[model samples]
Target: MEVSYREEGVASAASSVAGRLVADGVPARLAGGDPTLWGEDAEAEAAVRLGWLTLPRSSRELLPALGELAARTRAAGLTNVVLAGMGGSSLAAEIICATGDVPLTVLDTTDPGQVRRALTDRLESTVVVVASKSGSTVETDCHLRIYQRLFADAGLDPAGRVVVVTDPGSPLEQLAADGGHELVLAPPDVGGRYSALSAFGLVPAALAGADVAGLLDEAAEVLPLLSLDTGNPGLDLGAALGGAALAGRDKLLLEDQLSPIFGLPDWIEQLVAESTGKQGRGILPVVGADPNRSGDELVVAIESDVGDVRVDGPLGAQFLVWEYATAVAGLLLEVDPFDQPQVAESKENTTALLALPDLPTGAPAFTDGPVEVYGAATAKDLPGLFAELLHAIPGDGYLAIMAYLDRLAAFDAPVPEGADFEQMTDAWMMADPLTLRTLLALRTDRPVTFGWGPRFLHSTGQYHKGGPQNGVFLQITGVVTEDVAVPGRPYSLGRLQLAQALGDLAALETRGRPAVRLHLTDRAAGVARLLAAAQEA
Candidate 1:
């Protein structure tokens, strides 16, 4: 838990940004921007509302309250913990669970099979925690309704089993209060992405028996070290990277030495993309990617803790540091750090898609076996098709590989002999996608990024739909060979997976993104083909 702090490269790199913030009156003005310091203001109201500045102080309350709820779960003998939230709400806890001894299952995907699997297997012994800032996130709400019915069918009172984390006056709080579910109020000012240190993350961490107080202590150590005038580590970093982006080094390439904590990169992606990406200006986050080939990128190498993820050391400190850095980056870029104007476009489109009386048949404009193409039609022509897509990217453009598939850590099913590595590569590609991303970024002149389905929808989904139009989306979809059935539901998990995919596609196309849908029959082979095509291009 004692994470070593390497101040060598980071300190030098961050100096310029810190200097610029001072010159721009950024440090002094940030006080005006933060609601914690000056109440609500028109300029940075939304950004300031999210829990960045106040988290250290608020953690004192969150730790004890979350501990009490978690203790309740333990007293009730609830061993299985399932968290239902998307993007920022779930990412930090995902990392914590992965790094610590906590066994918290995150249900962030809309992949029906996974959802059914999570809810059906251990309903009697599980405690379902719904974390959402607005208390009205579409996925969280949809999931809560299903779980509510599942609990009802199991003859268990859903009220006693469910817990919620949201702002005081949000619908989520009302639901928890009215239904008798455990209600944990996140700081009213904190937004979704910035709520990691707030109840949104702590409740789950505490449920998993993580050291909530220790984490706050670690954060406390770093909080005072982040002031702009003092040239502290966090401020130095915030200015360095944020200033670089404003000067056209906009692709923030993140290389991960942080294993078992792969969540860090994704966490940073949401922080950077959602916060700084806006108004035709943004930092395109490249996570777990070592393009090893750099072009207009500011490479950030993260050397994570050598031991298990714990709050005793720099692990907890890192979050506060990055959060502060992101806010400062926003200040330097002259953009509101907290507001997400474009994130709503995709949500509205998804709602519209989900509401249609009859879903449209997703017939392809181009066909190739199980690999049907909506635009690029033939297998032999795929490499060129992809190359053309890559070629079309502007100097400032970026590439996003959006895959819809099961991202299991290990494949239990049998595979073709000598295909285990390839199959595993296929699976890991969906989860991390760093190897493939590095390959693509190296081959092209643009920054490359990747994420699993429904998962990224909650993270980079907003930037993809709302940020600069300078993005090319390569959406990968495949048929689920196996399916998990949701009892009493008309459709199986396989059907639901396709529904979410189609809905997202509709959302993307409606937004005018230059995107392509590649259909594959076999998940492994298809992903392999996509990789081959990207490299060939």
Candidate 2:
């Protein structure tokens, strides 16, 4: 049961890297040795090296793919872009779309209804980009099926309308070739989550109309700047943080506005968790824009101002810098900086859920009078529409509950349900416990609605961050007042700061989880500005 480096040669190499860091005044430590925990094997070491080495070359090559994607998207007369993938495959794209004012939708959820709705409703003619490193991920496969169904329904050629990005030899590559779909290849050496600079990120960036070439160029330029021996920021930062972790500090915190960068945090989590967690002891890496220290030891903040600014794009740069720094920091701690065990558990849970039978359906009838629409000018004077369905025949309760439960469950499951057929009334009631009173207030078949701000912020935000890592967050912010003038003194500034703090906390709470934000200026405007901004930069 002794915890020590299993391979003398690998240990020696790691020690060499640690020695270089120490010589340059950076702290460095080692992690491994537990017979029970899976330590670094030869493959892990090679993967780490390959991850680092491919950065420069991948950046150079990804530029052309991005340019071509942009050209193709424009040529197809498409305005909206939909990215379908899960885990590392989709996180980077989600991050980029969230940062800019790009009209893009990302389907990271495995929930069947959510995916079906995205494809049938919002993504009808939109160009769909499917990204997966292994090409065999269940969630990605499910999404591809939905796309195919939607394409068939619309009478469109699925192959011509779809694009696939993956490793050259992956099953997805073969599928793309067989289907005659446009294909983008990730470097053979690059892992999925780490392939942000590869085709995984570049295609999405192109769809968002971002300067993908600039992003890659910026990343490539930083490769030479990272050195294990020199006091290079990347190396030194990694060493200091990793060393601190080995010295009994387990938590790493990232602070930034664009939350999507937490995708990199997810990437870091896998890196640190799998690499260090091998031995009897390991560091717990948590990614958040707002650091909430419950009992965490090491707190490393990527100074928002420093590093390569031009290359990172608005939000992408911030994430790239943080991701690079995190890797370097792990090196300083002398831990193998890549590996993830929790992923297997996630997949296992998803598979189990997918095999379960669909829930029953039943909808309760609404009996209450008209709903009091607050902020509405007409109010009670408007048509007395039944806000709740209390008198109508109850819809299939089992199906509705099943659907609702499926949505909530997928927040925690790796493979989500494809369809939710539960009664809408019963499903709404089950989804939110607080909605009981609201449900009692409505009548007829009208949808039971919840207040946007106060209720969602107070009730859902808790589970969004504090609950199990399975919840998905959708933050809706409306600018109805047009920068409403606030009294200067203590209240205005205090409220603004508080609002920012809460937003930051929400962002942090859902870090590495499924989340999206819709910021709209006017409530009257039909279109709510929706983007997957949760993990942007």
Candidate 3:
């Protein structure tokens, strides 16, 4: 594809950024608690900064081991692999398989429907890759417990079928050790978002039949170009983006007009959002969004050289390219690209919420009505309130739907599994957001985003609270009629889910963000009704 800036003055800035890359005299200073870049010293920032500098070499070093494991997986006759993770731990593997060439399904969402689907999938032969850098991510841990129970109930040995990816001493590392699960330790310096080239992404790629060696080689081949003082593709990209964002084009629309691996933008969105989305400024990377491109937007298209784009080049190489570019943008923005100060607030709030004895007992901030009517009230109720919120967006602002509803849990309401599962549910539950993105983009000259709660809390939540204050958030919460109890935790899945939703609302309110919360009577049906009403409206 093509990569160009829609804003002016970026070319000169690219040169300046290239110069800064060399002149800083700290090309590799990040790994050693260097603070000259951001002029701050925090343990978290210092420890996580070196991944991009050394991950390429680490990947090259680990090639043989990865290949061996790939052979073992093939011998095991695994036809499909399912990855259970969140945000950084999951996004890279997603890109590795986004072309649909990789026989993999990434279970990154906590939607019960998605989890149940994973539970019922080809468990007899499917390989399970449990990836998480933090080792103790709430979602990953809970998912592991769920799968562990399932494996036990089915008389299957999870350790023989599972692999663990994490740092050397993280909780998952210990879990793998305690359970005899295959383990791949990521380089300790690498942050989750930067761990793609590390075993995190490589193992999955190797298992998926991608040339892991070629990917690393391609990544190494680009090092010379990326380190250059001028005309470096990756460095220049950083300059263009950083320069443009500083010039008020902060909404980066990352498009691949001709790539089969179109989901590359999803990974990039997290990289850009989490890295630079702090200090009251950040790049809002748009993935799969192609409507109402505004004047304040910068479009960066990643396409193939000639025909329709596929993952022809080493994906590992592209990962480094984007990492370098995003780091450069962070430098230009004067924000620490390594630390997420706001992400912890949601987690802490969720934890506090989990300790509670019951769900929030107060009335919802707003409710349309009892969601009993199937066609009229069931549909019109949500859309009516949504329209009010949509109309209230500030000038040059975007609309964000923070859906805290149990997307798949409630929908599992005794419906015939095969006769209507595919037809009854929106394809992948994506229609609601895609439809809203289309409608909201038309209704207002601004972008529209749909974030499933708690999941996005780890991905884009930092941007919502700590980045630019230009979002009009609409929250959808529902009664969790059915719930799954975390095996050991004091609370149930329904409680954890609602805590995350309410915790997010608290975080938003803590930031004084403009928001509206609607408590729905039914989780899955409410979303369907909302979409239907929007269509009719």
Candidate 4:
């Protein structure tokens, strides 16, 4: 792995941090799994979470089992591998599969339409891999219940088609064992985000035909350098990241277009944001973001030459290095990288909202075409509502668009029979939330970030609630045309999704952040109007 700090300020700051770390014997202590780095309160969590430090070597034991599972499923004609997970459980595997060009369907959202699509799409030949660090993850639980029901409805034994990956003693483990399903026990000490090298990440990726062994090997090669004071890619990158943030460059603009690994920034975004975002201070990662747009931003490119700092390596090494770097950054940021305290706020709020008589959308401030604009704004149209939202941005703050709708909402149109994968993907993006995000970005000089709902709830939702308070939020939610029921739960998937959005909106408002909610009464028309309004804005 190679990490270069080019700018004079960043280089000097990083060099100083490296020297201090060396004097303090940080590299050796960290390599040895010492847990006192983040101070007294975080020591216990740090001790348990440091399992990731050894994953590069220790995770090799699971390769044979993972390979066997893949082969067994393939032999049984289960060619469609669908992963039901969220945040760390899904992001790592998603990136790994995408990088390897493997076909792994990720069910990381609670959107009713999305869930229904996964349920009906090639169900006969599908194997569902349910992953969660803790067995009680609501989203994963919903996925398990729905998939099991679908499998049973199709006369296929859910036990034979379902695979579980979780901590040994988690509730899901017992359920999987009781149901006679294959279960892979993850290290109890490893946290979800840090489990990229653990069973949680490898299971789905390996099943989808990614080179799990090669990933571990790549990570292992870079492991030795992490213990060195100088010439250590992890330490250098961490120092640069932490130092830059401390020097008022708290907004991290990540560029990964030139990296061999695809979708790396999304994984890194979750890692860095959730790891450091707490106590009202943290780094906010903007993926595929532009440069020189703001003074408080630092550009870090992974295996890309066009950035203030460039970190280059194989995909496996990249994961391990970034994990190490985030830990080092936590020390500099004076926060525990292992714990996401504020991540539960939205979850708790969602639960509360679900228990209410109805999904409390509270009242729309006004109607804007097919969009129901909510929050404290008098705007009665899309453009006016958008203008008000933009005007809410603070001088050094950013704009975050949280979409509670299906990420595939724009891909409802059928593609031509002969359309290639890339072309189909392009067409999808053109009509997706990304198009609206691009238009909004052009309207603002400040950083603009877009995140898919419940998915980001597990990712950047931490930063949105616990990080800097200067953020202005624009939340978009759509009406569910075909709501899917959660077997044992009273609320449907659409209700759960809406509750999540409302819960997160409440969380942001409780933090005194400016937020606006645009509810889509008609998904297609609302999206078109939003896109057109943003273009005009």
Compute each candidate's TM-score over C-alphas.
0.85, 0.57, 0.87, 0.97
Q: For residues 3-38, write the lDDT of model 2, one tens digit per residue.
A: 122223323443555676556433221111111111
lDDT of 3 by residue, 1-537 (tens): 113443345556555665766688534443223556665554446555666666666678777887788788889887578787888877777777765466677777655655667778887777788888879888888888888888888998888788898888888988999999999888888788877787888776677776667667767777666655554556667777887787777877666777655478778878888888887899887665664656666667665432111223346667877887777788889888888899999889888887777756464433444443211122235666556667767665667877765444544444445756676554544335335556556566677777767667776788888898878787766666556666776776667777887788788877666666666576555655666666655
Name the lDDT value of residue 264 in candidate 2: 43
Better of 2 and 3 by lDDT: 3
Which candidate comes out best when scored by lDDT? 4
Of candidate 1, the 10-residue stretch with the lowest lDDT total is: 304-313
Per model, state how many residue pairs clash.
Answer: 5, 42, 2, 0
lDDT of 4 by residue, 39-153 (tens): 9999999888899999999999999899999999999999999999999999999999999999999999999988888888999899999999899999999999998888888
lDDT of 3: 0.70
Against the reference, the lDDT scores of all candidates come to: 0.70, 0.44, 0.70, 0.89
For candidate 1, lDDT tens digit of each residue in 1-537?
A: 222223333334456666656775656455334433222432457554645666866778766667778788889888788999988889988776766767888888766656766876678888888998888876677678888888897899988788888888989988898999988887777777777788887888889887777777878877765554763556656766765665666787765664444467778888888887777777888776654444466766566433111112355777787877787777667677777777776566555654666555467766544467774333345677677667767777888988776555224344556776778566565433234566677777677788888788766776777667788887777776666555454555555556666777776677576778777776566656666666777
Against the correct fold, how does model 4 do in TM-score?
0.97
Worst 10 residues of 4 by lDDT: 287-296
Per-residue error at 224 for model 1, in Å? 1.6
In model 4, what is the error at residue 465, expressed in angstroms?
1.2
For TM-score, the strongest prediction is 4
Query: What lDDT would candidate 4 get against the real structure?
Result: 0.89
Once superposed on the true structure, which residue ranges of model 1 sit more than 4 Å away at CA?
Answer: 1-17, 23-25, 28-50, 258-262, 304-313, 376-380, 413-442, 480-513, 521-525, 528-537
